[model samples]
Target: MTFKLDPKMTLGYVQLRVQSLENQKAFYKLLGFTIIQESATEIIFGSGSTTPVLILTAEEDVVPRPSRTTGLFHFAILVPSREDLAHVIGNLLEIGAPISGAGDHLYSEAFYLSDSEGNGIEIYRDLPRNEWQVELDGQVNTATEPIDFQGIMALYNPERAWIGFPTGTILGHIHLNVTNLDDAISHFYLEAVGLDLMTNFMDSAFFMSAGGYHHHIAANIWQGVGAPLPPKIATGLMSFSLILSSTDELNKLKQNLLAQNVSFSEVEGDLFVKDLNNNDMIFYTQA
Candidate 1:
């Protein structure tokens, strides 16, 4: 009953609809993401590689998503080291950015912030892989506790001016707000798109990952039970990419979707499927 994914599976670029291009550029630039591609209507940003990690598309007169909506909860950026994480917090402090929350999640230490359009963001570094504790039921134990801010800051070198995201940074995970956990679990995650269950908290939230990492995806009804989908014109998540290691693996998932009778669209060489909540998950293989 192991619900694992291909070892090479990874999260890729996240596309978002933003109210102001300049605002997003300024925010992401300060965080060390460089513009890799740009157009009149869209801009692609990368952490330290040419591959796009975050994409922003222009949305005119976009409405802000309501709190009680089923959509993006947050997109997490995982840096290579604790020192890199400190650099993120340091830069935020220097820019006077408003942080919504900062916590030590047992397995990782993270700081939460939001883009100008209110899309949630988490910048974090994981603890050593060996230190993760798993329970009898095979769920990783994660707790929300205060981060050692002082300790993290002490690692920051004042000699080095704060710059943007480092080379090894990656789009670590995407967490979503869903109306029904059961539907999300069975209809979308397990049956159609395969992802290993990592943890579950009460009946409210659960975490899933591909290759033994804490979580590559998470869903929660934290907004409200049976929350409605945000309007299309709302400034929020558009879609996110899941990079599979090989075309064969991608085909297996495509077959799984077909068997479940899930509607999907194929573009070029990739496939894209929508979850029960209508959130788009794009599957593509790298060369």
Candidate 2:
């Protein structure tokens, strides 16, 4: 029951069912996500690399999901440096992008915003590992202090004028709204999915990660326990992916899920399952 995943385990692209592809595209484009691919109903966004990070799919009849439902809370994007992260803040300011909030969470400084479809987004830069505050249990201690905006802006260089997300930008972490905190923490992410419980808030939320790097995924009961799933055809997170390092690591996860009696299906060598929060998890091997 104490299964551990490969340390290199990382998240992949997040797919959201949006209502207005045009509006969402325009918004993410301003944030420096490049359009990697496009079709009649979907537009994919990526950073400097060919790897896609976000997929926006919209149908004519798609509607916004209600706020008090179980779905994505936000998807956090990790950039490589303070300068790049500051550049993003400047870009949003220059374009008049509305910011929901910003935070300096000890280990990282982040800015929060929502997409055109109301899907939450976080753009952040991590302080170096040596700079993080660690607890006696080897867990990282994080807090929400006010970010040093003036200092962050001081790192900004207008001459660099970076056009898109820097090469090292990646899908860092994802937070979700779940119906039950206990089920999500005990039965789903920790035991079955092989993530380690990194740390937790005052019982309303918990952060989980693989290989102990702050939090890779988190869930909260802020909407109240027993929250209902978002309506189908609702515009929000439909699914997201986590890529493992190898087939062996994938097998370990499969065994962990089996041991926990969690149902999963294999399709074309990829594993598919739904979490306790009704969030779709697609696990696949990248190396």
Candidate 3:
């Protein structure tokens, strides 16, 4: 069934746990995110906007988990422009931070990094929507190519350095490691959620999104099948929540799930479900 989705609607933000408040604060600052609010144990970072992208709370003597576990693969931060990305990349190089990887994903260019505490971070800039190539079936196609590091470096104007992320930028997407890709695709794509399938990799990986964008959610078994979920003691993803444009859309999603016999719970009027990897997800409607 075809439905209309609002492009302005997207992932709101992410709330994460951290072992040390000071270290998390300093780490985020290096990425150009400004501290908007803070308390003794909690600090919120964003682009100086009302909507925060990253929220970190200090925990007492907690241990973090390896990325292989079933938890947040990475939190994507969307930059306003390529120059903005270059500014952050230049700063990271100056500080000697080890980069995990970099790639040009046709629709966007991205650099990957990890914080001192092992939380994954993706700094990326999206190509204009009109520049994206769409297939005959209305599917968006993205190619993996070598990122132009030198070309990006040329835009690294010190005077135009990014002070903070741009407003309206958001979490963008969340990737998960699951035991069974086909099961996950069926549960999230065909049942519980209303996302359209973007691409699938034959029982190994799958990507889905709303409004025809590349992907807001993706799952893969590259880590390993039957891997244990991340322990609650770790500093990592708290949960993922999707905000629908209106109550009608929310009801439609609920009805669709019900018709497909998907199981979910209701928490404070929000539909709650877990992915095949046991990652928590909440779906609620906005006025």
Task: Report the C-alpha lDDT of model 3 over 1-287, residue by residue, as the tens digit.
Answer: 54433344487667788888898888788767788789998888775475667788777867787666777678788877888788778877877777889999878999998888877788888999888877788777766789999999998977764556656566778776766665546656645576777767465667778877788887777778776777777878776777788877777777777776777888788888766655567777764
lDDT of each: 0.85, 0.87, 0.75
Each prediction's TM-score versus the true structure: 0.95, 0.96, 0.86
Lowest summed-lDDT stretch of 10 residues in model 3? Answer: 1-10
Clash pairs, candidate 1, are 32-164, 32-165
Clashes of each: 2, 0, 0
Which structure among the candidates has the greatest TM-score?
2
Q: Candidate 2: where is the Cα deviation over 4 Å?
A: none
Per-residue lDDT tens digits for candidate 1, residues 66-174, read 7799889999999999998888788778788878899999899999998887899999999998888888777898889999999999988766765578779999999
Q: Is candidate 2 or candidate 3 better by TM-score?
A: 2
lDDT of 3: 0.75
TM match of model 2 to true structure: 0.96
Backbone clash tally for model 1? Answer: 2
Candidate 2 local lDDT, 35-62, one digit each (tens): 9899988998897687989999887778
| Residue pairs clashing, model 3 | none
Off by over 4 Å in 1: 1-4
RMSD (CA, angstroms), candidate 1:
1.6
